[model samples]
Target: MVSKNQIKRITGLHQKKFRNEQQLFIAEGIKVIQELYNSSFEIQEFYSTDSSLQLNNKVKPDIISETDLKKISCLKTPNTCLAVFKIAPSKPIKYEGLTLVLDDIRDPGNLGTIIRLCDWFGIEQLICSEETADLYNPKVIQATMGSIARVNVVYTSLERFLKNTKQPIYGAFMDGDVVYETELPTTAVLVMGNEANGVTATVEALIQKKISIPRFGKLQKTESLNVATATAILLSEFRKNLSGK
Candidate 1:
């Protein structure tokens, strides 16, 4: 049985301060919780209708009332499971392959989708601006599907990380050299910016080179692509070049 106080604490994680104070965050949906349970991340608690708990012996999941599950869950509709996981500390960044650095991407869906894209492209490391949405925000976690386990998302100062990187840096820009034409570097920092605003002056100043995606659609109305979609295209090109595609 999930107590009222316990529900209060779990729901409080919706706010950043609470999440930090407790060192835990909520993960909804059966699949998302299942993935976390299987990862190195420690699962503090989980709730499911079934009392058997046969999936993982380590997980001593508690049974909770449907109403209690709904109260603590972030989703509009309560999923089959909700898990409380200890927030993982930032890991040592091993920047060997094509890395993506995001500049203040505010949207949770965009960040989550980007994480999924990273998983698909086999890009292991992602560096985000300090102001970017929290990777463990329930929305971002859910949107990632199951890729959260694979991608190492580090939230730090984009400028500092870019400045220190030994590899070349490529910033995505609207008014820049065509991505397809540019001689793509094997290993580098690919900077993608916010949905509404592009890279800020501070981050922009650190960029050593700029590249852009050419739009082929009939409508001249589409001036720029969404940051996440643009990210997919750019990474696609870089990966293809790496594979001799």
Candidate 2:
């Protein structure tokens, strides 16, 4: 039983401009909402078709009909629940451990998957170029599953960040040193480029080292690996040697 005003507000969050204006973003499904609720992100509105669904037994959600839920859901088949959360304040970037950087990654799904990959490898800090997709984009949020709650993402100037950092910067390139053989530093910055363009020349110039995943197939015809897939493989290689230590 959502009011017309509430419906407009919630659906408006689907756009980046409206989301920024409202200082809020939407998350759907029990897992995503629950993970966010348990994290530092503050929940503004919670609506679900299931009254039995609970969030850590802390706050009860408003029960809404499925029709009303669909009115605001970004997904085609709406989940049983949706929650609007206040966009958490950006935290300071900690450069101690392996830091992941993105150079103009425009796809929301790619950005979200990369965030999840960062969470998987325990990479705490993710730096994105200002051109990267919005972290709070609903597609990105949905793709993150629940890992968005864990990773700290910041959007800034890639060139400035690279120039200012004392870390050994590495960029993923199709034509570069083999990643598998390269000795990765425990403390470094790894830059992944756009899906179509790879790393921008400006940022690529700042990379202290360039690494690539070698193609093993006989044809070697594949143009490139998907950015998120490349990220997972590279992160795995970076953390592989240090796993047990």
Best by lDDT: 2
Model 2: which residue pairs collide? none
lDDT of 2: 0.92
RMSD of each: 1.6, 1.0
lDDT of 2 at 120: 90
Would you estimate the TM-scores of all the predictions? 0.94, 0.97
Q: Estimate, for each residue in 84-199, the C-alpha lDDT of model 1 and write its tens digit.
A: 89998878887678899999999999999999999999999999999999887889988998798888999888877887888888999988899889988768889998888899
lDDT of 1 at 87: 90
Over 4 Å off in model 2, which ranges?
none
Q: Rate the local accuracy (lDDT) of all candidates.
A: 0.86, 0.92
Which numbered prediction scores highest in TM-score against the true structure?
2
What is the C-alpha lDDT profile of model 2 across 108-144, one tens digit per residue?
9999999999999999999999999999999999999
